[model samples]
Target: MLVNIELENAEDFVFIKQLLEKIKGVKSVCVKEEEEFYEDGTPKWFIDKLADYADSLEEKDMISKKDFFKFIDEEICRLNSQK
Candidate 1:
C-alpha cells in the first residue's frame, strides 16, 4: 500500500516524517518540493532567470551572432588541430 500526506508547513512535514519513520513496514518516506517546468522540460523559473541575464548583457554590449559563431568555429578548429 502507498500513502500520501500533504502538509503546507515545512516544520509540520518534518515532524510527521519522523513519527512515520518509527512505524514498522514503512520502508521509505520520500519528500519532494514541487517545481514548475516549461513545456521543453526546463524549469520555468530558471529559464526566466536566464532571459533576465541575457537582457542585462544586451543592455551593456552584445556580440553579433555571426561573430559568435565564427569565434566558436575557430576555437573548435584550433582545438582539433592540437590533437
Candidate 2:
C-alpha cells in the first residue's frame, strides 16, 4: 500500500519512527521505490516474464527474489533505524 507521509520540520522528518505504527496491521507488502528500483538495462525476457506474470498470477506465478531480498533488507533497517 502507498502512504503519503508528510513531513513539516526536522522533527517530522523522523517519520521513520512511526514505522511501527504504520506496519501495525498489514499483510504482504510489495514496496517498489522509484528512486531505488528503476533502471534501463533490463532484459527482454525479464520484462516479458513480469508482464506475463502480472496478467496471469494464478496460472503462472513469477516473482523477483533479488528485488524481494532488497526490499526486505530495507524494511528491516528502516524498522530498526540502524542506518
Candidate 3:
C-alpha cells in the first residue's frame, strides 16, 4: 500500500525513514516537500511539524491543521480573487 505522512520536523522524517526500513507491506512511505504555508507569517516549520504529528499518530490517515491551513488559505484567496 501507500502511506503518506506529513512530518513535523526533519528529525521526524528521519525517524519515519528509519522506521519504514524495518516495516513491511509499506510499499513506499514518503514525505514530500510541501509548498510553503503561511502567506505572511514567520514561515514556520508547519509542514514538518504536521508530518511529525502524523508519525506519532500512526494509523490515522489524515492531514493535520498545523499545515493544511496554509495551503487552504492560499487556495481560498486565489479562488476568491478570481471570482
Q: Which candidate is the best by lDDT?
A: 1
| Model 2, runs deviating above 4 Å | 1-62
lDDT of 2 by residue, 1-83 (tens): 65654444546544654553577665433433333233686766677779987887662455588978999999998989965
Candidate closer to the true structure by lDDT (higher is better), 1 or 2: 1
Q: What is the Cα-based TM-score of model 1?
A: 0.55
What residue pairs clash in candidate 1, if any at all?
none
Ranking of all predicted structures according to lDDT, beginning with the best and ending with the worst: 1, 3, 2
What local lDDT does model 3 show for residue 58?
54
Across 13-45, the per-residue lDDT of candidate 1 in tens digits comes to: 878989999999899999867778878989988
TM-score, structure 3 vs. true: 0.35
Q: Give the runs in model 1 whose Cα sits over 4 Å from its true position.
A: 1-16, 19-32
- Cα TM-score per model: 0.55, 0.26, 0.35
- Candidate 1 clashes: the total is 0
State residue 11's C-alpha deviation in candidate 2, in Å.
67
**Model 1 Cα displacement at 26 (Å)?**
17
State the local distance difference test value for candidate 2: 0.61
